[model samples]
Target: MRYFILFLCCFFSYSLQAQAPHGAIRGIWVTAQDSVLDSKTNIQKAVENCKKAGINNIYVSTWNRGRTLYPSAIMMERFGVAIDPRFGKRDPLKELVEAAHAEKIKVHAWFEYGFASAQGDSGAYLLKKYPYYAAIGPDGKGIEKNGLTWMNAFHPLVQNFVKSLVLEVVKRYDLDGIQGDNRLTAAPSLAGYDAYTLAEYKKEHGRLAPPINHLDSNWIQWRAHRLNKFGKDLYQSVKAAKPNVLVSMAPNVYPSSLQEYLQDWPSWLREGYVDYVVVQLYSYKLDEYEKILKETIQQVGSKKGQLYAGVLIGLEDGYRAKPELLKGMLELNQKYDLPGELFFYHAALPKSGKMLKR
Candidate 1:
């Protein structure tokens, strides 16, 4: 029986490797901030726009700003609320999945705001229900950076709750993959001073946690390692529930991602935890963007097939790249032999729906 199970596993792995997209895995991210997801008409239009632009995959945001975009039994069970009221009973994810699948585009559930419970929204459901789970900072209060408040990434309760949220969707939805962005698996380096993490750290290391020095190399790696363990568990859990569903991550570029956000993505790839990785290489200057892309290529090395370049064609901050600039970025991706590219957003694509000429 064990040998039979091994054979099955080997066959599945081989099938995945064989089925990977031979051409670029052209993709786009649809974020909650766009609000286009609130209507079925908008979802259909969005999928059609992506199809016209040659996007083969859509990483739709499933969780954000303390609420889910889809009908979530897990959210309802935990918080007494299922979908974001703004959605008004509309399952945007389901709508997108159906539309995109009909168009032959794969859909991945993007958990954009993974551990983040709130962003300047004090009365968030998770925050109001379990305030104790919020991560504490050096100020000895719930840590809030750049208007975002994160749950204790190291707290067992937080990990279990968030994992359940992720797995819930995996079990309930026919998704092509599940994704974790920068904020999901990585926390601000200033966090983990919370009581739960400190106590847990002491138990493991036999000493109190370090003072709030964001640049503390040892301290940064320690917290990142904890998140890495979470990454491994998340990948395993998703695979266990749906062996064919891909596990993807789009983290900030390395070293900075490690020092500032405590994201150890390179290590995660080395450990074979995630099936796909898209390093966020958003730069306004083409030269700077290429430099980052070059470094990212070097970092991923032989694991090139598993990594993609996450280009920033547009941002909510009102920054949008010109068509020529976007084309240049795609050329660079092809130049480096990278598997594919994922735009930062769907709305960023030109309304004309024309594919960028290579």
Candidate 2:
């Protein structure tokens, strides 16, 4: 019976490998900030694990603390948090990218813009340096949520500068792609449109600001457009700088929340800015995950690009997956012929690298 079981396993493994997704984006999301690249040995070990497991792509980093991982010339004053030669730090991005390429794996640089200053360090610097793009309350008071600082998206310069900094990474690195997390839509029903946005809105849209007490449709719509613009400009900038490299976006699934908190990801997908996007479905339930996957893929609507379904492995959010989870997910993959599946973070992959192995 044990031999019979083994036979079945080998059979499935070979069969799956024969048809494994290729020419399709497959990888895990990794970061280089808030955490150092696990020692070079570990970094190579992780890449080796991925190659052995048949994973072909990795999304790593270039920006943190409003600072670009690559050494900078422009952001030195506004958000560049480091100065010493260590600022560039021994070609961190290059080594990672090279390792991945050596194993036939592709590396895409991940950029988490919008919310800056993980703790209290960079927040205070940006606020004091550029109050124009810095956060302020409706009462015209500066807003601070514990330690997370936000950039004023309404400022044209803010958008341009952010896009340029991101472009710097694309220009400098031979990245396989760009992994962009559209993380700054702010919140729905969030208060404090502020005098900065109000004045800008009047000038751009030719309308007096609506009262904060009432939800403003025009304002919301305009914000969504700006969000779309960010994606458009960033994608174009990266592609223009490096034509072969792809672009990816990590966005939440809830549509309303995306519009209110994320600037409307649907529009970004439809408009063709994102080369690919992973809907962080973060689902634990087999059926629910499949449902969200179907819904998100439906949005791509014949656009020829990769759509990696983000799986929630460890956390139990109704989408918490267990042993049967991979089986169920593979069932969906077979049904739709999905290009690949993406786990939220590099650390989240099962210790054996077995689930995403095939």
Candidate 3:
């Protein structure tokens, strides 16, 4: 009996050790240190630093703070700094492709899909220009009413807008892939069924929406389907634009609940919209995280790119990433044979950045 137990333990241990982190996706998050097209920019320096850090991939932000970081014609129609604004004209997307290519690092554009913020006088522009796009705030009114806003993904214009925007970015940049930001997504609101969206639903289903205070399970399920369709369509749009450009997404927590919330990540994966996925595993407990991560990875399997465990800062000792947590993630990579791990943000990484070095 003792010998059998020892053999079983040894077999599992051997299996764990022999398993290598498998998949093509590996790397870290990236953001602009400053303006997107600033002339003083040293693209090579930034890429080299990432390469030195052992990061083989860099997810670069192209838009934030009501600014589109790349030279975007779609954005020119939206944010009026200057048509073909000089920095807008600079084309960081192209630069990223070239620079990262030289370093042999894959570069994916990071887009905050459902959220947009304007920190300055531009706030009014968000309100007046795109009132229909904004979400309903806590008070059941447009976020614009509360001085906060994000585009309603359920809206057709919004869908077309995101699709076209993604196409244009990829066509211009020739990037390795595209990824969505986690917090940048919507919180799943039935209220976002704005007039246009209601019209769309009505048109499709041949009926008016369920009355307020009357939650229709069928309507909710159908709405969820529409959302999943939208996500798949987004993936299709990017692939159609550039067949080789990888489509990756970072979904909100709990895939099942999120589907109703509007993300539908599981369906996206099973149906195969995303080629790679960086799940946000910022939990504090090493043991719990490991189990959750392993199950998540196992669910993803070896066919799709090995899940890029989304390791982030601020999760207790995991955030500090001292002895156990960091080491454990690395160990998880080895045990699962995952593609590798990815950090959540560029600025959040250590100065040396040696922890993730290739």
Candidate 4:
């Protein structure tokens, strides 16, 4: 009788452990450039694909490049462009939300470009209309990095504009959540040299000019603090608009995220600015990916329950994540007992789902 009781206890424990990952978040991001949103039919098909793959959530890119996927009065009022011309009159966000909800899958409006005004346009569309909104570099030109042009993330005008965009969506859509990735409350560390930021810095720091070296520790902290405040405000605003709308962030791994982009997500997590975070741990190697995952787990510590690992499944350049590597990463996630994972994109769902099913 004693041995039988012990076996029962062990079996239940194993059963609980096995069921954990299934209950955890299984999410995928649907981007604007992907074919999944090209038509309403595609949106329905994508949601069906998600259901078959056991995905419970979808982060649809509502904002990207210099326009919105949905028709936006704000965009039209500000830039004379209501929606991405690529889709004609189709409202991708509305269609996607409807389709996903029909399948009982949660949808989050993802602001993919964040404060980025344009990509490879020399700030043509929105920036041309409001040039002062552009984040200025040390050379007195618009801040352009990695083919993306940015707005002044520290400026109140920029903050208000982004807040308006988020609130608009929250009020209009029946969304499960709203998400901001690496670019939302983040600015290139080399930024903050813009006239507005410089003046604000001077007012706070005894009228001293910002150090020429952008990498100065104090400078970085100050910029990061401003971003933290923006994050807090954004969170509060979203909650006020709809208390149930989850505020999610998908920033890059910490310390490096702080050093490169003024994204101090650790502080955001600590202060309750985000409901959860999916730290981007994309790597091609299993060992390196595991090492990073372990380090991230340690950093989050007691807050691991509010963390989700962001996995890169594939890129547009035909770089599909190997099934073995993906299986290994999922195993690592299981070993660490992570709460969930959010795949980088939707295009690789078939491959990823096959591995997940196995």
Q: In candidate 1, where is summed lDDT lowest over 10 consecutive residues?
A: 15-24
RMSD in order of candidates: 5.7, 7.1, 6.7, 3.6
Top candidate (TM-score):
4
lDDT per residue for candidate 1 within 61-123, as digits (tens), equals 888888888888888888888988888877888888899999999999999998888888732
The 0-to-1 C-alpha lDDT of every candidate, in the order given, reads: 0.83, 0.64, 0.63, 0.88
Candidate 4 lDDT by residue in tens digits, 1-358:
9999999999977765554423478899998789998988988988988999888999999888888889999988987888888889888898889989999999999999999988886236788778788898777777887889899999899899999999999999999999999999899988998889999999999999898898899999999999999999999999999999999999999888999899989888788889888999999999999999988888877677788899999998878899888899888888888868998789888667767542
After the best TM-score superposition of candidate 4, give how far the Cα of residue 256 lies from its true spot, in angstroms.
Answer: 0.7
Best first by lDDT, ranked: 4, 1, 2, 3
Candidate 3 C-alpha lDDT tens digits along 1-358:
9999999999976664444322445577765543323542556666767777777888887665556667667766676652224464566777777888887899888875345444344444655677776655334566432233456666777668767767777887768888775523333544455666667767776686544531355655665676677778888888888898888777644553453355556666678777766777776668877877766765665433435678764322333555466667767766765657777666545553776543
| Tens-digit lDDT track of model 2 for 1-358 | 9999999999977755544323455677775542336456666887877776667888776666555665566666555544323444555677788888888898887776544433466435666666676644455655555355666665667677667667777787788777766454342334337566677667765676645542466556676666667668778877788888887777777575454454576666677777666778776678887888788777766542456676655532323356688668766865776767776566655452677655
The deviation in Å at residue 31 for candidate 1 is 0.9
Off by over 4 Å in 4: 1-23
* TM-score, predicted candidate 4 vs. hidden true structure: 0.93
Compared with the true structure, the alpha-carbon lDDT of candidate 2 equals 0.64
Decreasing TM-score order of the candidates: 4, 1, 2, 3
State which candidate, 3 or 4, has the greater TM-score: 4
